[model samples]
Target: MSKHIVPLEYETGLAELRGDCARMAPHWVVPAKAAASPVAASLIHGVTVPPASARLIDAMSDYGD
Candidate 1:
């Protein structure tokens, strides 16, 4: 016969408290000047891949397929 192990029970409301704290924590906001700049904006929003890099990525994606 196999014995089943029971998981431990955490204190009630702990998860809710943690989530509340996380929601209340301060977050960084990008400056308007930086956001207005093209390069800075691209970096802040996401990485901008060059055409060559994109082609390389595409090639890699097809690898081992």
Candidate 2:
């Protein structure tokens, strides 16, 4: 998947978390009916943000230094 370019806040957090952030993953939950509902279909959904990358991690590490 392509890397997401999130806001600096997320980038900073991800950088601070470092390796621990590896466990993070995109997640979503919706009832079967909701998933199939016209409203749900019409509504904009899904994670558009990209995950953090090595560059982001390194940059975050330098935050307080």
Candidate 3:
């Protein structure tokens, strides 16, 4: 006689979650901010923000309290 082992439904769900975690693994590592110094210098000099950058800042501002 031969026996078969079957995984439960939750096991499949867990496997899918594992795959998602793997795909997002790189996002877990913060990338270096290479342009930070230039941005900071511009801010210190009171340089005007471009319209696109200003819009991005406005959009991102709504993401938090």
Candidate 4:
């Protein structure tokens, strides 16, 4: 059986998603510093924007040899 390979973009996007989730997870109340930054606000939007075909690749790639 051939090994399945996830694309680099999906992996990178997933990493970003994980990081964003971790960053947000610790805060029930957003910190004043974090909440006030435009950069931080922009990153929040990225949490919802996984790479295209990310879910499909994730599901299918589990069968790798």
Candidate 5:
């Protein structure tokens, strides 16, 4: 006989989460602000924030007391 594995709600949730993670593999494309000076680019578009980092930042903000 053959056995199979099934996903419970938690597993399904994790799978969906993984899918979301995969979809957002690319970091946010923050373009350099045209109106601002060259220095602004260093502050704004310097760091590329991947989706995972965005989620973590949101979670941290929520949990911060």
Candidate 6:
């Protein structure tokens, strides 16, 4: 199966991280349930304005259970 990533920023971040910033960060690593929740999308929660170090990995993709 092919994997599609919705890198945690506006469209701009997709371009940024895909480039040399391979190790860049998303605003947050969301739980699959929360991330996929239609209600949550409307809310658009964040982990504060800016994290000290925003680098995080979500290799697991969807965090189920």
lDDT scores for all predictions?
Answer: 0.72, 0.57, 0.75, 0.67, 0.73, 0.53
For model 3, how does the per-residue alpha-carbon lDDT over 4-64 read when each residue is reduced to its tens digit? 9996655457789899999999889787977644345545765688999877777885752
lDDT of 6 by residue, 1-65 (tens): 99999767556666765764556446447566645535656587765633333323233345422
Each candidate: RMSD: 10.5, 22.0, 11.8, 19.5, 15.9, 20.7
lDDT by residue for model 5 (1-65), tens? 99898865554677898888888877657678778545655566557879997778778956643
Cα error, residue 51 of model 5, in Å, equals 0.4
User: Could you tell me how far off, in angstroms, the CA of residue 8 lies in candidate 5 after the best superposition?
Assistant: 51
| Candidate with better TM-score, 3 vs 5 | 3
Candidate 4 lDDT at 46 equals: 32
The pairs that clash in candidate 4 are: none
Best by lDDT: 3
Where is model 3 more than 4 Å wrong at Cα?
1-12, 30-65
Q: Per-residue CA lDDT of candidate 4, range 1-65, in tens?
A: 99999766554577898899899887867657645535555556535537766666666857421
Ten-residue stretch with the least lDDT total in model 6? 50-59
Using all chains and alpha carbons, the TM-scores for the candidates as numbered come to 0.24, 0.16, 0.26, 0.24, 0.25, 0.16
Q: Who is ahead in TM-score, 1 or 3?
A: 3
The residue-by-residue lDDT of candidate 1 on 1-65, one tens digit each, is 99999999877598898887788776646557745534554457555779997777778857524
**TM-score of predicted model 1?**
0.24
lDDT of 2 by residue, 1-65 (tens): 89989866455565667646555533334447645435665577784544566456656857524
Best by TM-score: 3
Off by over 4 Å in 1: 1-46, 62-65
Off by over 4 Å in 6: 1-38, 58-65
The residue pairs that clash in candidate 5, if any, are none
